[model samples]
Target: MRSETREASKNVLGSPLRACCHNPQTGYFRDGYCRASEGDMGRHIVCAEMTDDFLAFTKSQGNDLSTPNPDYNFPGLRAGDRWCLCARRWQEAWKHNRAPKVVLEACHESTLEIIPLSVLKQFAIQAMN
Candidate 1:
């Protein structure tokens, strides 16, 4: 593989944590990197495990990710899937007691700039390496 290919396997923090998931798509660049840039207003850095409650919560907020959008190449999401979610959205869910389990290693480091590690640990997916 090329150097670029190998480098993308690492998280935004420069660690070799496995990608969050890709079946339903992820990453700000859609490369499964969960990376952020100036253009990414949402700062999608949280690697969250999907659940029915969280899905419903996001849908109620007007961002229905579970509904497939063929025009956008989106296949939608289902329970048990891992996704790169916007930091603020995840925080909102947490505030409303609907947060999902987070995969720390898979999460982009930029999340630390929004929410603290302490809060993330409260909903982390323990045992992930």
Candidate 2:
């Protein structure tokens, strides 16, 4: 049932969006997906499970869980809404890289059909730095 729903969503969403981050100093490519909202930009279809690592990371960053949802400029994200595991991990990875800045230039959504683990690894490395 879940797989069916995912497939249905994939069909409707067209495909995941992709973005690349390049280090100006070394011209390294850091690729990843840009999370997007579904349905009139009012709802996010991504589901994440909170984990210990995520809790610790958010705690360390001083992100108060008690606060209202942040104004992400996206429709459905409300303060206090917890991120799914994937989103949490994505954020942590971005933070670890300290990539100076992550530049997300849009790419064909179909081009990002598969999650780029390599790009994620690179992001992690940057975050760790």
Candidate 3:
């Protein structure tokens, strides 16, 4: 028997969190949402739209998001793919001028602890009306 549970999480907008990506089945739990648990040290909660520069930057950092890993079920990422990334890594990318656009509605509120909302807003893919 198997069961699935979702955390009562909120997005950066203080609203109910939304799914980030489904094509790659993102999230720390691989459930398409950017929720994180206490044990999730990586804090994979920042929902970012991939870019060529960002992918190359991350790969240089040794994460290698573009390489397919069958053992882990990772089908490799390409530009335009939406992924739940580590908050700190995103900040690092920002510092290097390679940060990808972020989806505020899909980013977990906990990400605020690592990256400021103002910074995230600067790279938001959509403007809040």
Candidate 4:
């Protein structure tokens, strides 16, 4: 279900959440923004840049993100493509040291509920630079 009071869409930094990607039309709502509301069981709110290792890791877990799914209209992910990932999935990948870089400005603040800001900072794309 949804939160009693809808929170303003913001990022982990408490700023307005930016679009994660429009190319693949990411997001649980397929609106290119990392957000979640009622019925979003997966909580796809983490803006993560795809990587081969991460893709392989997810595929091994039975979620083959790299393979296109025509039924879902998914174009399949590849290294460098940004997508709205599940917060718990990113945490799992982080535990395995296979997590991809995150775009903090695009990651929904709700992600902080599953992944600490510090841990997310460790994998921040801006931090890598």
Candidate 5:
């Protein structure tokens, strides 16, 4: 059953992870390891359930912008935004905790364009779990 489950997951998630597994510019896996594209570089491993945890943790840290005097600075932030600036702050915290290869690679690519905070929040939420 475990093997079957693994196979099922592989079938579902294998493609995108494989496609984004390598840094196109560098021709190397985001983790700095060199392997054929067929190899599992473990790049796209993140869960969706951790969003609430990230939200709660950031709120507890006093960075929740919904509260007055938010712990983090959000220069251009405005009121009534659905996305919490605090959540972006939490992602920054998560980034510092450990340098995952895939995330490092994504960061590298992110500089070329703006990565939306909401997308990042989703990624962080998925990653934590």
Candidate 6:
């Protein structure tokens, strides 16, 4: 059986939502949606509010999230930007105290499988009410 995280059929807690602004490239499928499917192994499920510190830290770890790369269709990232990030990567950042804030409405519930809800709640920016 597939993991619950891998079986997320819709955006967490809401309808299909746009996780990122597409002026530049974003999203696992590059469709600007954070929805996951059977083919998505990295589990790009968290809609994180990008920050300079997290971006720089990710870059230092060799991900280079800030540099635009045409070959991979990556238009690059910037502070205050929104993007779908892998659950594992986000949790890893949290482990190191580099995890950025998150948009709860945009974040996939699959994230809860890897990270605690209370932890995510601590970084939440979007209001549920």
List lDDT for all candidates, in order: 0.78, 0.29, 0.88, 0.87, 0.29, 0.73
TM-scores of the models, in the order given? 0.84, 0.28, 0.92, 0.91, 0.22, 0.81
List the lowest-lDDT window of 10 residues for candidate 4: 1-10
Model 2: CA > 4 A from native:
1-8, 11-35, 38-46, 66-91, 94-129
Instruction: List the pairs of residues colliding in candidate 1.
Output: none
Question: Residues 1-129, candidate 2, lDDT per residue (tens digit)?
Answer: 121222223311255332222111110111222234332121222222224454445556765333344473222323222332233334444467422122222222221333343453342211111
Candidate 5 per-residue lDDT, tens place, 1-129, comes to 111122122212222221222212111223322122323332222211223444455557664423433243322212212231222343454665521112212122221123343444334312110
Model 4 Cα lDDT, one tens digit per residue, 44-89: 9899999999999999998999999999999999999999998998
True-structure Cα RMSD, model 2: 14.3
lDDT by residue (tens digit), candidate 1, 47-107: 8999999999999999998999999888899998888899999999999999999887787
On lDDT, the stronger of 5 and 6 is 6
lDDT (Cα, 0-100) at 82 in candidate 1: 84
Which regions in candidate 5 have their CA more than 4 angstroms from the true location? 1-50, 66-81, 84-90, 96-129
Better of 2 and 4 by TM-score: 4
Model 3 bad stretches (over 4 Å): 1-7, 127-129
lDDT, residue 84, model 6: 85
lDDT, candidate 5, equals: 0.29
Q: Candidate 2: worst 10 consecutive residues by lDDT?
A: 21-30
Question: Which ten residues in a row are the worst by lDDT in model 1?
Answer: 1-10
Candidate 3 residue lDDT tens string, 21-102: 9889998889998787776788898999999999999999999999999999999999999999999999999999999999
The candidate maximizing lDDT is 3
lDDT of 6 by residue, 1-129 (tens): 243332344445554443554555456677665666557898887888889999988888878889988898777889988888988989989999999998776666666778887898889887222
